[model samples]
Target: MNRRVSELGERGLIRRLREKFPSLHSIGDDCAVLPGIRCPVVTTDSFFEGTHFHRWWAPPQILGRRLLEAALSDIAAMGATAKWFFTALSVDPGIGVNWIEGFYQGLTEREDVILAGGETVRGERLGITLTVIGEGEDRDTILRRSSLHPGDNLWITGLLGRALDAPAKLEKAGGLSGKDLKPRSGFLSSAELEQLRAFLQPRAELELGIKLRKAGIRCAIDISDGLFSEASHLSLESSVDTVLEIDETLFFDSVKDNPLAASAAGEDYVLLFGAPVGLEFSSVGCSKIGRAETGNGEMTIFLDGERVSINAKGYDHLGVRK
Candidate 1:
């Protein structure tokens, strides 16, 4: 027997969903809720085979874990606790049954979160879409992109440029980018190994987000794009001039000299938040890197007291000078 949407209708469909997926609370409301969550925080992301990621980049399980990590970063940015996630996959059977099983196994690595029901279908190429839901204490506890204000200090978690390192090397090895300059070596330094691990498996700042929410941080963003792009976004969002006064200490040892590369390389997945000037967060491993200034949606970068110039991502959309 087969079922049709017209037969069940909307209410009936919701009732079925509630019955089948008992983990979700308060289904059929304007917004569904998770158990014990006060406010719902929802975020969605789409990943395709070639454009966003390449299957050959990592093992199926590692790739699946990384995808979940990337999407969870959004929930972390909202200062919320992720409780559930629904994943939709478009896979070709040629991709193999073991690969699919391994992928799902990887997604279930976190016991705290439940994998809600989702749909899967055959497609020409692989595509994965994830919808993650988290919770905050209340409406006021959720962070906002527009809450950063002038005179607030900008803080970032973890080293920058490491996330882009592994992918760039992988692309070069796959001959997508430029040719690899040097041959692969068996001996790898601890730092070099760390960079590769950072990309293959990145961890979202989940506990940090909860702490930031408890600490009353009103505005924050995860560094998914590049530092430059994220800073421009925050500026446009808050309608303030974002100024990054950076030093080599703010970056990984590899790209410290290249300010433009360090600033533009994305996918760090670290938290960047604005706190009141003079406020310190030394205990939480956060570095005070910049400040939000009074202006209209412009971003400025200063390296060692000298201002550098470059065309940046979302720079034109913000309608600002170089």
Candidate 2:
């Protein structure tokens, strides 16, 4: 599967893939043209087996839903509403027709998103990539790492660490059984299914972010790499320093205070945004944990006013293993 290929063969492969999927419109070779939207944004991403996901851990439908959510998070970060998506899928002989159909079923459930078209091919391993096109108003377009300013209050939506830290409760006692991790109503009697639902399928914060932008926010990013790494990115890009005061009370029962763990673990996909101090947003549950400063050129997170060290770094795609 990893054999070296001639340059001509690679070009031929790309040409054939393009031939299978017809282009509906031509804006540029790199960017998709959106005639209806005055302000349009195009984003492209890919997910691969044993990296973006573990096939043994997630069902095909759930895997598909995760793929869609990851893309939508990017749109939401820009305060844009998703319009449509184009998908390209390649699979090894191990995949079946039923699995592909189930994948599409989950993808179709998202609001305001339709699969305009896609391509398919037979390969040595399973993989899928999607390019999502979305639209936002001129005022509502947000940016990541950039656009931050001095004295802006940093806020993150939703609680962190619950979904990933909590163990997948088993239905049976046998350790070897694959059925142990399957969704069960009674496995964790004390835990609410709705809470786990967010981790499993993170809905984009499009409306909330757009509303925040309309309410006068200028800088923002989605918390895919958790709070620690993203906060540093914001500080570095905006040419400012930040003091992150994490709200310890918002954590789930299983929450722990390993800073590196919090920062490096991806897939939370919540919005982390900056607003001017003294703004009131009663609609969304946000906690003001940090402030941008200009004196120091580093991120210093304070827990009850003291600096601490942690081991978590952001997710590296190659680092994730089956």
Q: List where candidate 2 sits over 4 angstroms from the true fold.
A: 1-35, 139-141, 162-196, 257-260, 310-322
Error of 2 at 19 (Å): 19
Reference-based lDDT, residue 115, model 2: 67
Error of 2 at 290 (Å): 1.0
Alpha carbon lDDT of residue 148, candidate 2? 81
lDDT of 1 at 234: 88
Instruction: Point out where model 1 deviates above 4 Å.
Output: 1-37, 171-190, 312-322
Model 2: ten consecutive residues of lowest lDDT: 171-180
lDDT of 1 by residue, 212-298 (tens): 888889999999998888888889999999889888887776566665676677888998999997678877899998999999999
Q: Highest TM-score: give the candidate number.
A: 1
How much does candidate 1 score in TM-score?
0.80
TM-score of each: 0.80, 0.76
Q: Residue 274 deviation, candidate 2, in Å?
A: 0.6
